[model samples]
Target: MTLFKVAQLARTAAARGSRSYSSGMFTNAGYEASREHARGAVETWKKISLFVALPSVAIFSYVATKDELAHIHHLEHDPPKFVGYPYLHVRKRKFPYGDGEHTPFWNPLTNPDPEE
Candidate 1:
């Protein structure tokens, strides 16, 4: 009925070279093997989950602002500037950074650019 019981019966059937795992369906683990398998799986999962979380959290915590999009906008486009660059002309001038503006025209003025 339980997974470990199913596994153990399958193993037994496979060892006997039987044609079906279900052929040994009545050969349940009689409680002991099922209990042992469940206990081992829970203990192993707890240890693995704890171990995996440690490195994952530590690695992500140090990620740079340069790697994220939000910080870069505050630097460049918060205040639009006027220039004779022949691009960003009059009326076309817009606050180009903070609100997810990462284009070439906006990036140069964006505060705390993510790449720097």
Candidate 2:
């Protein structure tokens, strides 16, 4: 039989005090109204996410990168001078692998000085 009919039978049985099949729970009286409300909420949130949240995130991302992009452009045009100090770039003992001085992953363009 249908769930509602089963519940009704369980309620009737419980009222008679034969044995309580149902634990005093029943279906929501406003289930259809609640479901419609939930559907409306979902649609509203979807619109908000697509129109408001998406654009806000994209604009924030662009704004965040704008200054960093300008700084990168400036650095590319005029890089800071490399200073030569005794402690800096020191090689008191050679590394166990790969020419002992320069690392295998070292790039000449970035770190140009590899000892004269």
Highest lDDT: which candidate? 2
Give the Å error, residue 107, model 1.
14
Spell out the clash pairs found in candidate 1. Answer: 66-114, 74-111, 75-110, 75-111, 76-109, 76-110, 76-111
Regions more than 4 Å wrong, model 2: 1-28, 84-116
* True lDDT of residue 8, candidate 1: 100
How much lDDT does each candidate structure score?
A: 0.61, 0.77
Cα lDDT of model 2 by residue, 1-116, tens digit: 99999999989977888554544224464666678889999999999999999999999999989987887777677765677876777778998898788778865545556353
- Give me the runs in candidate 1 sitting further than 4 Å from their true place: 1-29, 64-66, 69-116
User: In model 2, how large is the Cα lDDT of residue 37?
Assistant: 88
Give per-residue CA lDDT, model 1, range 19-52, as digits (tens).
5446332456556676788899999999888899
**How well does model 2 score by local distance difference test?**
0.77
